[model samples]
Target: MGRTLVQKLWDAHTVADLGDDATLLYMDRVFLHERTGSVSLKGLESAGRKVRNPEQVFCTMDHIVDTLPGRGDDTIMPSGKDFITTTRAAANAAGITLFDIGDDRQGIVHVVSAEQGITLPGLTQVCPDSHTCTLGALGALAWGIGSTEGEHALATKTLAVNKPKSMRISFDGELGFGVTAKDMILHLIGAYTAAGGVGHAIEFAGSAIRSLPQENRFTVCNMAVEFAAFTGLIPPDDTTIEYVHGRPYAPTGKTWDAAVDYWRTLQADDDATYDKDISIDCADIVPTVTWGNSPGHTVQIDGAVPDPSNAPDANTQTSWARALEYMDLKPGMPIEGVPIDAAFIGSCTNSRIADLREVVKVVKGRRVAEGVKAIVVPGSSQVKLAAEAEGIDKALVEAGFEWRESGCSMCFYAGGESFGDQERVISSTNRNFENRQGPRTRTHLASPTSVAASALAGKIADVRKLG
Candidate 1:
């Protein structure tokens, strides 16, 4: 029987199909970040338990790593260094691999895992962070869980997960230049609305997905939560295999060939079934930016904010009004000339070397807007090393963008530092959730290139013009 990509991957890693619509899934890898790991470890301690599979566990500090100079080590992390320190100590005591602050391997858990080749096709993985779905780009079955659930997995090496209904988002047309996975996913969120995929596992398939670079695919899956999907995935392909090759945790020599062969076998069968499906014309999507708090409230820069009259339904009109009021935006106004106070070009979703290089192409020989603050934060120390080797960092710094140490930075502003209150920022991070970047601040999310262009123009300008 033909199978859908989700089913294929799901079945491949099912340790046991426990009765009751849920499965005792086998998790080959587990990730923990500072914010959630601390509580999970505390739970394990309360239960007088030890990690069941220390080898499969990995911990990284990213969620609050300050992206500014002299603050990269989180000396003043709002939770006090104690929270992050406890997680590091717990992981170390449990024999779990820890990417502690300042560790070369340290960065966003998802970025470090992929950079180190820990996320492989056909693998079942989970993390305490929702963006764990980013690993799905490597064809892994990955998703997020709560602190208590993470502790349960850490203690037992298994998760009781319901098999989610599947939705296939197929695409066929070629994406236009400067149109990236960030744009595609933003468009998807807009088309489906934030709650459209509730309770479903989304499989992003078809030619468009296969053609995207591995980093871009990561960007696509990283924001699955915005659509309320349990997870988002892309099947492994040659690019996936090649990108994994030679990394620290990747298969080597004879084993490498065998891994690829087995990975290929895990592809969906020709007749695979899905609970629901939608096909998108890739050519129809344009470079996109978020106009409101939710990712679903996005429009092309050239497009105007939604006028209440264009509302598709009563519910749509209400949503539009709410978003407009919350964001302090005027409906029917063109977005291109919206002034920005700051620009950010890094996040777990778009801070890979590929993203940096793409922005470098536009930023070289150009300078950021004089009064607009901007920074380039790599997702991990390894990403920083890779970008520096490519001289992307130098280009970015030369273009008036500060080059900072690897950390989540302004992507999370719970720490003391943040953009101005009520200031507008063009960012490359995943969520535009209210107060996500800072209290009372406005955020417009876009691709790395778009952010760079905006930083230079001091407004929400398109990257195409920078080129």
Candidate 2:
């Protein structure tokens, strides 16, 4: 039997077999953010240990940092400055590269990692954020870890990890108009349940995945954790190699040639077999949105809110009932015309330049609807700069959206900036659990274009209807 891509990457990084399905795997890159990084760095200091390879580790101010213009150490989140200052001091003391506030490189860890070429094919990476799985778009084996595990990887450059069963999800057919990578993922979770991929390392494959741009691949893999997968990855291909070729931290000259040769071979063998396999018909996917708090509680843009009484199980029925009550939604109500108070178009999940461009396409020449507060935040400063060069930012601003600095803004309620209480929001960010955006703020997750359309309509408008 041939080995899957996950098997190949796992075998390549095995430092030692620790028995009982656990392996001491070498981590090629370890990323950190102010939110959880301070704890790991402080713990390492208390233990009197040093980073095994500081050059391979990187830190940034993102989690609690304010994304408002002219922002500095001070943040809207209570004590947010302490997290920033302490992380800066600790990162400096440890000798790892720090993308401090105001630095052009400052951004979300996952976004910066990809943009800087810090993650590449076949490498193993980890961060203290769940979205670290976003890096797997480059065909890397990456996942999230706790602060304690972060310290271990920093000190030894290796971590003891239990091997997860391999699963392959093949997306067949082409995506229809107005549907996006975000919708594809949302549709998957909705169809299979969020726990569908539990305990498995999922490898996304097939025609639809291959057809996605590199950034779209990131959007798809970013939510693998939300799918309850241990991690997710896409096999690197020519598009990936092209994206990494000239990146600052990527290989150079002869090294680049050698790296490309290896990356081309990163795909699974023709006969490779996985522990589980699932095939999805992309033709059936549409512009999807979450009607309930859980991402799994999703429906097509034109579909009606499902009745909790029809839920598959008693537990599911109870949860759905609570979600409906919290959201103030009625069973069988059409989701298409539901009113929204805000629209957010940024997060590690969908804040890349490609995503912003999509937003611009929908919002240009159109003003936001009255009573709707809309904002567009790029994933990185680089992304922001690029969008400005192309006039994407100006277009958005002209359309009545606030053009803001880059960071994980309004993606979660961290006692900082957030939507008003009980506000209904259509957001491009991943995750829409109750109170995710603010106390009593009900979030509806959708794609960038969907968000822009909703912002203009002041409701959960379908992007497909824009035509």
Candidate 3:
């Protein structure tokens, strides 16, 4: 019997069989952010236990740090400075690597980990954030944990987790122009609903997925949470090896050769079986947008908002009605022309350098529409530097987009920063639940290009139609 990649990684990391599906798994790395990282660090300190492997832990400020270029520890979130200060003091005292505000390595936890080679294939990584699975794009078995679980991992270097069922989503065929990984995932969620992959860890495969650039795979895996999957993965390939090579923390010399050889063997066998299997043809997917609150409440860019009366069940009908009301959208209305008051182009989901480059392409010679407030935030300081070097930041700023520092800004209204109530926004960030960006803030999530185009048009515009 051939084994799936999940089983291979699982068996290798299993430290003990606790029975009842729970196994004590060795953890290779743990990344933290200011918002929840402080909670775990503070808890560990209160318990008088030191991190078993401080070197394996890394911390950065993201969730609450101000993304303004000249910003300091102060933030839009009330008492946000405390999170930054506490996390810094705790991290330094514990000897863990801290990417302080001015550090070049400072960025979102997931982005820094990948760009620095801290996350590698076949390793187990966890963080106190849901989007931790973004690292799984590099073939690592990574997922999010609550602050308590994070504390346990920090102290013991292991976590007792119930193995999840395995599922495979195969993307066959070539992607069309202007159709991105963001659209592909949105289309899948729309077809399968948000809860489709519940209790499963997804392995994204097939030619279309392999065709994506390494970092773009992060964009695809970033939305795995929207599929309700435990995590998302893509086995390391030649491109993966090349991307990992020369990264700051990547193995060197003999270690590098050995690691690459091992990563090459991390794929699922040809005859491997999975609990569920789904096939999506890339040709069938187009630029998509979410008209409702959930990622699943999506339609083609050219399509109309769904009428709740056509829903398959009463619950679904109710959900549809509520989403439409909150979104201020009318049934049968075209999604393309929906008015937007703000546009945000940053988040763990789609804020990489490649994403920024795409944004520049769409809005380079244009200005933001009058009355629209648009901002471009890089995913990390390193990305910000790279984009600046390429003049991407200049183009964005000149085109009327606010070029801000890197952080998870405006992705959600976690702290004091928000788009205010009842404002409609087209964003590159994930999720559009009611009040996610602000109280009553209506969010339509899309690709950077789409966000850029929508910012120019002051509506939910499609990138395909941009001149």
Candidate 4:
């Protein structure tokens, strides 16, 4: 009956019940970026309204900024650049702190908030990007909101919505080599399908999730959207506190201990309830990659693509066929040795220091294969600084990977640049939906190490083989 972290945070943030199943929840922090925030700002302007609490909101320029730094060209998506400029001006006018380009602290919103300690355990966080759930690694109830809803949060600090049911995904045992959190979640996605967790807030439990580092856990939580989960989380514990301590905005000295005590008090009671639960043995997971459109269309690198003839129903058959057609993949084809045109190692999902270090360890002495375009981008400016300080950036660049600036580059086609149409990219970013990287680009989602290995071999390979 132990109360889960989600319940405790929800209860603490609840302002009032709105209606049947709906609650007016007070958000602790709101993050804004380009694209969505500008539209929301225009909506606010159209409404002739002002933000209710500017101090609680933070803005950054991540989505539209040029990730290949020193470009000096500044040719960004038209709407994107406007959004950044407008959001920054509005934030400044409203007294909201803004992290614009050249802020030193500037980076992807998720990475910026995390590195700055603006996001902490037992807090309610929201952004206009689905991957905002990446903050849940700190034991927060973080999720994404629509532009209009984001505007409302900025002005009112509250959002009205029905409570999501809770689903617990328990993972046990240690993961084997090349098997990572991405594999564990991908396997879960394959088991549950894309919409499996619809209307549920998933709480990832068990030793496997708990034992993994923060970056990997963030990677797992980042893909909660692909499973149709509203948000995903792991409870804050010693690991959470250790990661937050001494961070830029984190509580310091005596205030730090007080905050820790308060965070502990937010744990769920022993008799808390969940709408559903599932378990997975981590030892069975392996280096994984997606062969089709949806994240569920994945398997062990050593496995072959599924033959849709195995589909239990016609709906599955249609799904399989559509996925295969979009991916230009044949049923039952071997997933390994599939040629790749590009390899990317970045995004909020797997662009942290740990991920870079892991990939560098795999490709330290190896050069990228001929005919492969590979690049490495850190998640945050601070992450870039940390990697370079440790010489990981040099190692990756020496191996022929482009070491670029920090941002959500190639995670999606936000910067007006993208992989060529019909090109195949082995990427560390989440989501393999059609055109996620470009209008007609193909994406193969995998872990940082797998991406590095694929870049070196110019094909999908089990990263563990390289080590």
Candidate 5:
């Protein structure tokens, strides 16, 4: 049988097998942000250890930096400024590249890395954030690691990890209008529940995946963690190569030619085998929305809230009941027109330039609902500039969406800004767990376009209904 893409990446990066499923894999790149980067860097300092290869390490001021324009080190979270300063000092001492505030290249770690070509096909990347799998869309073996593990990778350039079982999820057929990668992912999670991909490295493949723009592929891969997967990847293709070519940090000249040639070979063979396989027909998917505390508690925009009595088992029934109570939603209630207090349209999951552009298309001629507080944050400084240059920012601002600077604003409430307890928010973020946005805050996750429509209606309005 032909080897799987995961096997190829593993074989190429494996230094040795340590028995019991553990392998010492060479790490091609290590990324960090302000929140957890400081902890790892401080650990190295205390141990008087030097990075095994500083060139492979990079740090950015994303997680804790305020996204407000003209913002500095000051932040609303207590000691947030200290984290930034400490990371800056340690990153400088370690000789690692630091994308500090005001750096045109600065943004979310995942966004900046992809934009700068720091993440490429057939490489290994890791960060201390669960969504690090976002980079795996380029066919890299990327995943999250704990801070202590990050320290070890910094000092050794290798990590001991057990190889995860491989699975392939093929999205077939063509997606319908208003259906996006975000909706497709949400549908997958809802169908299989949150633990569906546990212990597996999911490879998203098939006609539908190939149809997406390279950036939209990032959206699909970004939510892999929510499915409980070890990581997620999409083999590189012509689309990916085109996206990487000529990037700021991408290989140049002869190196570029060679890289493309190699990346082209990164796809799985036709007869490759996997431990598990699944197929979802894209034509059946619609604009999806989460209805409760978990990403798995999702329903189609036109569907009704799930009734716990119809759940498969007692445990699920109890879980569904709790989610409904927490969300202040009733079983069998129509998901559309559910009132909301706020809307957020930015996060590593859905804060790219394309996401912002899609939202603008929905908000251009409409005003936000009178009682709604809506905000739009770009994923990176570069994305922010690009949107402004295209008049996207002006459109959102005029529609009453607070056009803010980059950084993961409102994706979660850790930044000292939150929608407050008991507030209902329709957000274009990855997670909707309890208090994900703020203490006791109820969140409904959806695509940027859906968020825009909901904000305009001041309720859980479907984008398809807007037209």
Candidate 6:
């Protein structure tokens, strides 16, 4: 019996077996953002503890930072400036790399980590943010941690973790037109339920996954946490190698060659076995959108809202009822043509340059529907610059979209900025939980192209139906 890819990664990073299913694993990279990172860093300083390896730690201004143009330390979120300034002081005192508000590298932690080559195949990475799992797309073992865990990793460079059972989800067949990685994930969570992957480390595989561009792979793994999985990964291949080859922090020269050789061997063996296995036919997936508060409450773009009575269980039925009431929607209502007040495209999940290009394809010559407010914030300053160089920003702005600076803007309501109360919004950000975008804001999660189409229609429009 061969071991799964997760087993290989765990074994390689194991510093010691701490017994009772816990292992002390050495963390190669630890990333932090202002929100929770300030707590961890401040705690470490108060305890008179020093970072074990300052060079391996990285911090950035992201969560709660204002994404408006010409912004600085001042933020609309109450005391958001304090979080930013405190994190900056701590990072500087700790001698760790910091990507400040104006730095080109400044972006969401997950995006910055991969773009800079700070995350690598076979490395164990941790961040004090749920979306940290986004970096797992590179074949790394990455997951979220609480601030306490962040402090521990920063001080000891290791964490005692319970190994999760391994699961393999193979997506076969080819994705249809207008379908995307975002839809693929939404469809999975919709079909399997949100808690399906609990206690498991999922490996996304099969022909469809292999065929995805590296950026698309990131989109898939980005939502594994949303699926309730401990983490998710895709085995590194030629596409992975090509993407990481010239990254700033990636190995160079002979070191690059050695790293590639090791990465090539990181795949699971042919006979490898997993604790659980599932197979999905890409043909069954469509451009999906969430209709209720939870991501699992999803339907096809043209599907009707399901009645609570049809829910699989009593708890689900109750959940659906609550979601429908909060959303001001009714059972049997068609999901499409549901009017929306705003559209947002920016988050750790779907704010990369590739995501922007897709949005541009749909908005190039079309104008946003009258009375619909739309905005597109790049994931990072680098992505912003790249989009500007190619006029992607201009196209969006010309189409009635507000082109804004980089950062996790309007992804969640942090009391700083958000959509209007009771406003219905189609967004590219992950998680559509209640009050996620604002007080009484109803969010619909979709792919960037789908979001563009919705913005144009001023409703929940299907990308496939767009002319």
lDDT of each: 0.86, 0.93, 0.92, 0.85, 0.92, 0.93
How good is model 1 by TM-score?
Answer: 0.97
What's the lDDT for residue 153 in model 1?
Answer: 87
Return the lDDT, model 2, position 109.
87
Residue pairs that clash (backbone atoms under 3 angstroms), model 2: none
Better of 1 and 3 by TM-score: 3
What is the C-alpha lDDT profile of model 5 across 1-467, one tens digit per residue?
89889989998999999999999999999999988978999999999999888998999988888988789989988888898899999999999999999999999889899999999999999999899999999888899999999998999999999999999999999998888999989999999999999999999999999989988999999999999999999999988999998888899999999998888889888999999999999988999999988789999999999999999999889999999999999999999999999999988889999888888888898999998999988899999999999999999999999988788878886557788889999999999999889888999999999999999999999898777
Q: Encode model 6's per-residue lDDT on 1-467: one tens digit a residue.
A: 88888999999999999999999999999999999988999999999999999999999888888988889888888788999999999999999999998899998888889999999988999999998888889999999999999999999999999999999999999999999999999999999888889999999999999999998899999999999999999999998999898999999999999999999999998999999999999999999999999889899998999999998899999999999999999999999999999999989889999999999999989999999999998888888999999999999999999998788889996429998899999999988999889889999999999999999999999999875
Question: Cα miss at 269, model 6 (Å)?
Answer: 1.3
Compute the lDDT of residue 465 as modeled in candidate 1. Answer: 72
* lDDT, candidate 1, 1-467, per-residue tens: 78877887767777898898988877788888878887898789878999987988888887756655666445454564766778878888889898887678988889999998888888888899888899999988899999999988888888889989988988778999888889999899988898888999988988999899888999999998888999988889899988898999888989988999998886777787889899999998988999988888899978998886689899888878887887788998998989999999888789998888888888899999989999888889998998889888888888898998787778877345677778889999988878888877899999888998899999999888765
The collision pairs in model 4 are 1-270, 1-271, 2-270, 3-268, 3-269
Q: After superposition, how far is residue 378 of candidate 2 from its true place, in Å?
A: 0.6
Pairing residues by index, what is the TM-score of model 5?
A: 0.99
lDDT of 2 by residue, 202-279 (tens): 999999999899999999999999999989999999889999989989999999999999998898999998889999
TM-scores for every predicted model: 0.97, 0.99, 0.99, 0.97, 0.99, 0.99
Global Cα lDDT for candidate 2: 0.93
Error of 4 at 465 (Å): 0.9
Give me the runs in candidate 2 sitting further than 4 Å from their true place. none
Q: Give the backbone clash total of model 6.
A: 0
Q: CA shift at 20, candidate 3, in angstroms? A: 2.0
